[model samples]
Target chain A: MNPMNYVILAAILFSIGSAAVLLRRNAIVAFMGVELMLNAANLALVAFSRIHGELNGQIMAFFVMVVAAAEVVVGLAIIIAVFRARQSISLDEPAELKG
Target chain B: MQSLIWLAIALPLASAAVLLLAGRRADAWGHWVGVAASGAAFLVGFFALIEMLGKPAEERALDTTLYTFIPGSDLQVDVGLLADPLSITFVLLITFVGTLIHVYSVAYMEHDKDRRRFFAYLNLFVAAMLLLVLADSYLLLFVGWEGVGLASYLLIGFWNHKPEYATAANKAFVVNRIGDIGLIIAMGIMFTTFGALDFATVGQLAGNASTTTLTAIGLALLLAACGKSAQFPLQSWLGDAMAGPTPVSALIHAATMVTAGVYLIVRSAPIFNGAPDAQVVVAIVGAITLTLGALIGMAKDDIKKALAASTMSQIGYMMLAAGLGPIGYAFAIFHLVTHGFFKAGMFLGAGSVMHAMNDQVDMRRFGALKGAMVVTWVTFGLGWLAILGVPPFSGFWSKDKIIESAFVGEGWQPWVFGLTALIGAGLTAFYMSRLFFMTFHGKARWTDEVHPHESPALMTVPMIILAVGSAFLGLFLAVGDRFSHFLEPVTGHVEHHEPVLPVPVIMAATLILVAAGAVFAWLKYGRAEVAEEAPAGSLATITARNDFFQDSVNRAVFQRPGQHVTRTLVYADAAIVDGAVNKQARGWASIGEASRKVQNGQVRSYAATMLVGLVIVVAVIVVGGL
Candidate 1:
């Protein structure tokens, strides 16, 4: 596939992940969706770096991966706490913070 | 003598500083510090007076610069003292009488918890009064002027626990401010005209100033004098100011504050001499005020307020004298000094009565006190005689001179002023007699709880000394025109002419009228019972009792209009200015409320909002690119 196709594929994946986060009620599912969106962005960054013949975008992708990994650790911890407190990880259940 | 002039002002100032700074630690004995300091200042002033007297006529007026008061590029003022004939006389009066009052206050204020604070304020007032008379420049005089006003305000409201006393203090302050504006304007005009603030330079230059300019200056000074001396329209405050402790009333009336007005008029004689029209107005004001004071005095049952009214009238006599060109300047001061003695003694006597009567101020409630309070009765009786212009008393020598001088001008001016003064004299005797008799002569009016007794030696001694002064000060000061001759270096040569009205005739007429007034008062109140509340009577009686409704007039003329204006301004400020600001805040708040709804704190809701924003941005970019 062409480098443009890779970018298009990553964009579609980002949209799908965004839809999952917007549609999902479960905390774990939304967190997984966020990770998927971050990976999709990394894939597009790498593809653009190769097409431009530059290391700047690829280097940026590496920083994104590291940030995503740290986000997973904190996100799962919060999700686990929610689950332990209420016996449910549903995002809808935590709407106690509604304005 | 010139170098040591600073000590007269400094000694009391230092005492005030020490007493104030030492605070409660010195409360037990701080009053003695005040007395000693004032006494020392009196000694300094005494030596200075003697030294000035010893100097030849040409060399008596001396000015000594202590330091630069205000140094600038184009303007400079010196912190100097002028020990001229005028100032030396004031220095002697202030220190001598100030020391006595301080001694009197020691016993008067003994029972009070804040005696230290009271003494400090007294010392401060004396220092300020000395500064007012001794300063070489108008600016320095103003500094001292404001200082005494502040000190009096504090002392008037010393018993601030009472709301009415505080209100009285406020009234005194606010009323005096109206006069202060006149002083400030006069000072400004004087500085502009003379290019200097020094009294010597201004006095010399005043003769050359245009009649219009001099008139403006004179009128302004008169306004200020009216405020300080409690003349005419400003006379109302003096009665209410009796709210202060008796010593304060005595000091303010005698040597320290009220007399400053006469001092100013006399000191600025050159200015008044140049403006004949202004001088005439001054005389007219004096005439009207003296009558008003005497008329009001007759109606008051409060002993201190009656004395206050008497003080106002006596100062009015001095003003009348000071207004009469060169002929009356010395006599004005002569009257002022004698008035100082008798008025102070009378006020202290009133204080002694109040002390004995459990702070009762009504004369109607004070009958049959003569036998019990022997010392106060005797001293007060002397004061009463002195004030009534009885023969050989201080008032006879001083007040009669003023009355004679009133007729010095030719034709109708003399008749109008002379007749007014003559009538005022009769009224003075009438009211003072009423006060004395109502308090001492009638059958016992006191309640069973009351027991009248003499004041302590400390208070009585001062009254006795002042009584002695009242008895002889005029005779001593008036012999061979010695007092007037001593003041000639400053006032210039006062023409000694044949009497306009023969002295013997004037004396006989005045004494007869005064005696007639006294007999009238004795017939009316001495034998009759006086009710605590004055019985409703004629229109004239009601008017006199209400101070001619001057306070009511002031309220109608100025206060109500001012309140309406203030209320309108407050409403406009609240609705318009605050409305604009609050509207902006409310606008932002409403927008914030709408925005706050977006933060539902639900993970899915925030994501959905972000997705919608992202779609809008992407769609805009795509459409633009196409």
Candidate 2:
């Protein structure tokens, strides 16, 4: 029907990811939520291109997907390192930077 | 010869420096060096006096500049010396008497371990006293004034091992500082009024100043005089100043330093002549001191203390004479010269007595000493006669003139001062004869263990020279009215004014009163037995014996108030000044503690703050777009 519906779906997905990232104590769960938020932003960019009847937004969405895939690899590696060192990958466990 | 005025001061000063700086190495010959320096100064001063005398009276004043005292200033003052008839007269008196005391001290302090230091201080005092009279400017005179004060303090506390002697020294210094304040204030006023502190400028410009300024200066100078001369309220220190060596008593107290006040008054005659009210106050202070000194003198049991009281009374006469303007200036100087010889002689005679009595100062412990200390007795007797104003003695010529001048005043002023001077003279006779008779004529009061003997030749020789001077110097100076003519150049011409009573009548009255006083003294202390212990008598005697309760009055008037002020200031400084600083620091510390609560090591709170800051920035952009 309308391209606006896709944009609404992307917004709902981004809110769910933000809630998971804030509420979760595990570092791996929070990283996965961040990945989900990046994919929702890419979905919004593609839906905006369809509404405008131009291919530029779709091109930006393709580029964002490639970057998100690479970021997932680096984020998973860090979570693995924190787990090995502390025996727990929780954000609260590595709260050394807190005031 | 005029340039040689500096040598009179330098000789003694250089000797003092050497004796002090060389320490123990110079001890053996220090006393001899001190004596030789003083003797040479006397010779230099004597030649200077002759040179000044040879010059005409108008040209007698010779000024020599030493240096510019304060360079690149609006105020002009030079460190200079003025050699004139007046200053030369003082120089001759100081150097002559000072040298004799030095020689006497060679023997007087032969047994003391600190005799070298004693001679150094003595030489320092002579140099300072010479400079005091010779200084051309008030600024330079102040330097000499303070020098003598320091020397007096050192000598007074010469035996500082004793706590009381140290206390006495402090008392003399503190009391003199009061007078010094007056002098400093006077100098300040002079600088403001005339832009010069030299005597020539002030004396010439004194007529242009208002009576109020002149009177203020005169009164300030009188206060300075009273402090130095031991007059009235300041007289409390003189009796205690005798704690110094007897030679100090003779040289500084009797011969030189005490007379400085009279010199100041006579030197500042222009100011006094303009300010008659200040002049009257001076006379009144002189009269009161004369009476008070005599009263206290009559009650003292200590031989040295008695002489000190007598010294105060005699200086009072000189002060009174000085207050009478040109009419009495010459007589004041004349009396001062004569008093220097006799009073110094008497103090030395007292020292001789003490030397024989194992350093005992109590007159009650002395009796029938006339037979043993022959030279001391004879010399002391001549001084005694001179002080009593007996015929042909120095005191009669000068003191009699003072008494006659005091009577020449108009109306009630004459009666008050003349009667006071007359009574002071009578009281002087009573007390001096009492002193003489009690020590030498009363029944023996000492135990068998004590032995009285004459002081050695060193002491007796000075006493003999002073005695001879005391005996005939009055007639020698007064003959053909030569003394008056000699001093006229400095004092200006004193018109021949008749006394209120005839001259013969006044002289006769003074003689008769003096005779009556002597007779009364002989009946009380001479013929009567003196108990070794003093009696606790009535109020008058008790007050007189306690130095008129002067210490008590000063304590109540100055000391208690000063303590309260100091205590209040300390409290204010602690509570107000310190509290303000502490409060400011505490406020900042509390603020820091409050700010630290936000930095509680929590990442969630920091993220929340960042979110809130972003929301505020978005809201501001939205509102501006609307």
Candidate 3:
């Protein structure tokens, strides 16, 4: 019944996803962490929508899933191109973008 | 409607326009066009003189308003031409002498490649000088004033291929601009005090203004006069200005343009009449310059430079007279007209000598030229006699009047000015005779390579006409106080006053001093075997040779200090003004350098930074809700 508990769960999941993205060197693993963060946000939204007696959060979660699917196709294609070019898909391998 | 007065200025102006715009295409006939334009302007001005003479003195002034010059809510000025006795006198002098000079230049500048440009500038000078005399308002007069200044600069630097000549031109322009500042400030005061810039309105309302305002205007006009007339402090340029063409030295520097200052003073009779302090200052400046010029003239070995010094001294006499009030205004103009003749003739004579001697200017290099150039000698002799104030000659009539008028004031004023004038007369005689004897009367000093011959009739004819004016113009004009009566409507009639000394006694003393001076010069440069090289002499002689070291004094007094101030300002600009901007720029750059660390190409670092920012925002929200 407590919507605050949902926010707390979302916070914990976001922390874990951020740790995976920051700690992992593989580009695919970091991308998977981004998907985890989005799912955690969706979970929090649904919990809030139920507490407020609305279906808006569920509709937004479906929209986010569709957007995430499109993002994965483009991001994965970019990572594969990077692998072809430099023989690596690690995030740290693209140091050409360094300041 | 003497609207035809504008034609006097327009013809030459049109010629100048055509020659300047046509460029090289006008070269073939440009000089002839220039001569014709000047001649036509003379005719217009000559007829205008006749028309003016037909009217009574009061009705002689014909004001022709062409259009509005500057339209304003509070200050409206008209571009008008005034044909009056005073202006007509100047017009006849300018146009007549101007035409003669133009004709002389046809031969004088016969071979120069830039002869067309030379003629264009000469025509431009004639038109501007005519406008300066004919303009009905101060604003309009200033336009002509600046026009002549430009014409003068162009002509003086006509041979700008030479660096020194260009520098001389710049010197003249810069000095004249300094004088022009006084005119501008005077006009500003006129606009503020009288609510108008036109001559008539200001003249009528000048009495209503305070003496302080009038004095300010008077001093300003004097400064302008000093610059234009080459009097005192502004005189260094006159000697250098001989770098211009011979006709230019004759026309603008000697005759017309330089006298614009005297004209300005005489024209603004009302303002000067109210400011006695300003008048005294003017007279003092005149006296000092008169003596200084004579001294400088005595030492110059260059014929043109010597004559330029003489012109300065002669103008000083006019200025001294001008500063004496209405009593001396007519005499100032009288001397101006006659000096316009003799000095311009002598300059042309110098030109003839130069032309004959293969452009050699040193008097030591010339001698016994009188035999080769008879017509030049006779005409030059006439001008010498006329300037010496010899009896029945022009200067005796005109210059003596100025000398007499300079002695008309009260107290020690007459003594100082009278003594200065007398001393100046003696100095003039010595120097001018020295020049004449050194050139025509002494043993031949020229080298075999240079053959002295008479110039063509084109040059001699003008010298002849000017010589005639030098000899008879004064005698005819001064026959019955006729010149004074003609100028009375503008200058106002002043009853004759006895000078401090009896006129006859003063005249006798002046003649005696002149004789003594001529005898002295004869003994030094004529009777003795003159040295081919100038021997280093006394400090006094060296001082005169160096123009009294005026340039050095000016550098020390104004230029060096000005440079220092400018340099200090540049340093301050770099340190204080720019320092603030540079400091801010460096501060921002350092901040940017620090911020660059955050943009490191590390996806893991960026994600960690974003996670920390998200946590901070969520914690703030949670604490606020609790």
Candidate 4:
């Protein structure tokens, strides 16, 4: 009923997605979680536009969705390459990216 | 004539370079080359001396610049030769005596494998000695001074196979370096005070210098002389220097290089004239050294070491003479020349004796050699006579003149110096007679295997020539007081004096004491049963035997402290210097190890750390806003 409820729901979704990305061992699941986090941000942007009665937040949300599409294309390609080379998509197994 | 002066040094230097460069290729004839080079230098010097003498007395000095030795904005030194009465006299002495020694070494070193190298060093020594006398400026003279010292070191250690011989060379070098400090400081002071280093300029301006400055310079020069001439405190190295070859002992140690200290004092007469206190110190040092050297000479069984001690005493006489102002300079040089002839002859004779006796230097093992080594005996006898100040011998004219001058001043000064010199003369006679009797007069002491024989003709010829000089040189030079007159242009006239002890009384006293000493030595050791080793008898005998314990004193004073300081520095360098660096590296390594634990190459750990930092930043921002 309140516009704040949508913002709160988006924040909860973002936290869940971040937790999945951090805790998951599989590379494909971690990538999916990242996309979910981006969508949550887009939802918050759209809700904020509605609350302000302006088009600025909605436009930012549209740009973010485009960026998410591009990110998905690149991210899937990298995961597929790593899976072929190592025969595994576990983030813990391919820990070469860690400091 | 001026241009030809350079040839005196150049000839021997070129010979040295050629022989050294040719190496083994020149081995067959290198010694001949050295001989010929020195001979040519002698001829050049002889002609140069004649030409110089032909000039008017006041016009005899010739200063010719060869090149710019050192060039700078504030200081400039020319590499030039000064051919004056004083320098020409030295040129003759160096070249003539050097030529004889070179020829003598040819035969003396015939059996040695390193004869070529030996000759090369000899030539180098002659060239440097010539330059020392001929140099116009203090800076150039210093170059020659160091040159001679280097040549001496090389020749002393020529037989480097023997460990002690090398040690002896090192000892001579280190001791000389101590003396060189005085010379270097004196030059620095002269440069500051006179604004010049040329002999003529310094001599002219030194008269106006403050007495304190003059005294410092004079004392500094005396220290240099003490080192080179082998006086008192520095006398220890001279005896050790006998470890070198016999020819080297003759030329560098006895005749030429050792006398350079005397030459330096005589040349700087103007400076000494201005510093009476410095002159007094010089005389005292001479007196002490002469007695010390004589005492040491009496105790040594080694023939070369005894001669070395005697050389020290003789140079001490020259130093004493040089200390007496204008009157002493001429006599110092006169004594230097005579002493050069006799001392060189005696050293060569010692070498000849050693050659005959399987190179054994112990006089106790060398008795009854008079018939076996006739030439050595005859020549050494003449040298012994000359050294004892016997009339008609070279030492009488020169040494007597010095003793006379030592008593010229009134009061206790004359009495002390005159009595000291007289006593030194007696000591000289005692030790020398002791050396002679022990070596040649006593019953046969050599083992059955020893077969003593005369040296080859080459060695004896030089000895013969030097013997003749030692016998007749004084009479020839002192006739009409010509030597003193000849040196007058440079040294100025010495004020005539009424003697403290009448001249006849002094001469009679010296003669009587010398005779008594000879008789005493003869009775004590000449007729007594000579032992393989002199018994360690009284405290005086032990002190003399130990070279007055000077070496022990030096070990305690300088060497022990130096070693302690060095050890402490070494520990500090390891503990502090290295520890500081190692501790810093260890600290960084521990930090790296702690940081490495955070980099476990795990994605979850890195993410957690990032989140924690983010939460802290957010909390701070929120708190500040509230």
**Per-residue lDDT over B489-527 for candidate 2, one digit per residue giving the tens place of the 0 to 100 score:** 789997899888898988888999899999999999999
| TM-score for the A-chain in each candidate structure | 0.94, 0.95, 0.90, 0.94
Interface RMSD, every prediction, one decimal place:
1.6, 2.9, 1.2, 2.5
CAPRI category for model 3: medium
TM-score of chain B of 2: 0.95
After superposing candidate 1 on the true structure, give the runs of residues whose Cα lies further than 4 Å from its correct spot: A1-3, A46-78, A95-99, B20-27, B67-71, B74-78, B110-114, B188-213, B355-359, B365-378, B438-456, B497-508, B522-535, B608-626
lDDT by residue (A1-99, candidate 3, tens digit) is 688898789878877877779899999888988988998988888887888899999899899999999999999999999899999988986766576
B619 Cα displacement, candidate 2 (Å) = 12
lDDT of 4 by residue, B221-328 (tens): 988988888887787798889999999999999999999998899889889999999999988888888889989988888899999989998888988888888878
Tens digit per residue, CA lDDT, model 1, B26-125: 9988999999989998898888888887889989988889999789865689989888888888888888888898999988898999999999999999
With a 3 Å backbone cut-off (N, CA, C), the pairs that clash in candidate 3 are: none
> How high is each candidate's TM-score?
0.89, 0.85, 0.96, 0.89
For candidate 1, write residues A1-99 as lDDT tens digits. 689999999999998888788888878788878988999999999999999999999999999999998999998998888889999998887777777
Instruction: Report lDDT (Cα) of residue A79, candidate 1.
Output: 85
Candidate 3 lDDT over B473-549, as tens digits, reads 99999989999999999999998899999999899989999889989998988877777788897999999999999
**Per-prediction DockQ, in order?**
0.62, 0.21, 0.73, 0.42
Question: Residue B163 lDDT in model 3?
Answer: 100
Query: How accurate is chain B of model 3, given as a TM-score from 0 to 1?
Result: 0.97
lDDT of 4 at B58: 87
Candidate models: Cα lDDT each: 0.88, 0.90, 0.92, 0.90
Best by TM-score: 3
